[model samples]
Every structure is written in structure tokens, then in C-alpha cells.
Target: MHTSEHSIMVNGIPIQEDDIEYASRSLKAASHPLRLKIMCLLSQHEMTVQDIVDHVGTSQSNVSQHLAIMRDKGLLSSHRVANRVYYCLAESRRALLQACSSLR
Candidate 1:
């Protein structure tokens, strides 16, 4: 194994440092069960906070906190629609979600 400032070489294959960092951050954010559930839900389509709370059978406040964490970690993106906030997996993280879904 060999490492450089921008990449790592394992078995003669180089992996970009940025990709590794992104994977680390995304995995950490989604490691929580509630957050994982939210990601799986959003993998299907964008949803409002209330919708996620209803589907996850949790309190709105609980859902909001999880959403905030995921948002801060760059695993999710959100926008306002009138009085509602809709959230979806970040574009860069969608491939990660797809890879996880394939395991199910």
C-alpha cells in the first residue's frame, strides 16, 4: 500500500483522496438508523419533513434534527416549497445511495 497527498495506491490501484473523504463523511452521517431510513426514503423521491416524520413514525422534531445533521454533512439538499421544506439526497451522494440500495 502506498499513499500520496491526493490519493492512495492499493494493489497498484489508485483511489482519489477526495472520493475517500466523501465516502467517510457520507457513511458517518448515514450510520444512524434514523438517518439511514431517511436516506432510503429520499432515495425514492424528495419529501417534506412532515412526510418523513409520518413515514418514519417519529416526532417532527426528531426528524428535523436528523435532517439538519444530514444537511450539515452534505449528504442532503433541501428547498422550500411554500410553507414546506423538501429534502433529497445530494446529487454527488446519489451514487452512494444507489450502491447501498443495491445491497438490499
Candidate 2:
């Protein structure tokens, strides 16, 4: 008996259509300049909302909104400690961020 397996491929690499939608969301989440800046900062270390506001030189409310978007996109993870919440790039997204940073 002979059997064969076939898979959809892109650039010689197998890929799923669903992956494109997910990638698009991540890319769109990082498209904003503020979000990109936040990603760069978070890439170094996790930070509280206030720490992000201080480093990014933006209003807390604006920073919070952007953080929410990134968080929703699965690009970032958050940890709550005491009265503060810290945010950082999700482990899986870190390499994607590194590739993005290199583009600049």
C-alpha cells in the first residue's frame, strides 16, 4: 500500500490560513508608534503602568489604552503584584518583536 500526505506550503514552508489572520493582528497591534515604543521598552524588562508612563513620556490614560490593545492582541502578558500591574511581551512574541526591532 502506498500513501501520500500533502500540506499547504508558502515559500517551501507549511502554513495555515489561520496563522495569517493571527499574524495580522499582532502586526496591527504593533503598527502604532506608541505601541512599538512600549514593545521596545518592555522587551528589556517588565514594567508597571506608571513605569511605562515615565519612560514613554506620555499621559497615563493614553498609555493604558495602548497597553490594553497590546494585551488583547496576545502580544503582552501582565502580572499583578501588590498595588501594581506589570506588563511584558509574551514569551512566544519576544522573537517576533526582536525581528521587528531590527527593521528600524
Local accuracy of candidate 1 as per-residue lDDT tens digits, 1-101: 54576566778898776878877988999889899899999989999998898899999999999999999999999999899899999998887777877
Per-model CA lDDT versus the true structure: 0.90, 0.90
TM-score of 2: 0.86
Report the C-alpha lDDT of model 2 over 6-70, residue by residue, as the tens digit. 55676888766688789888999989999989999999999999999999999999999999999
Q: Give the root-mean-square deviation of each candidate in angstroms.
A: 3.5, 4.3
| Candidate 2: regions farther than 4 A off | 1-13
Q: Model 1, residue 4: displacement in angstroms?
A: 6.2
- Count of clashes in candidate 1: 0
Give the number of the best model, judged by TM-score: 2
The TM-scores of all predictions, comma-separated, are 0.80, 0.86
**Candidate 1: where is the Cα deviation over 4 Å?**
1-6, 9-15
* Weakest 10 consecutive residues of candidate 2 by summed lDDT: 1-10
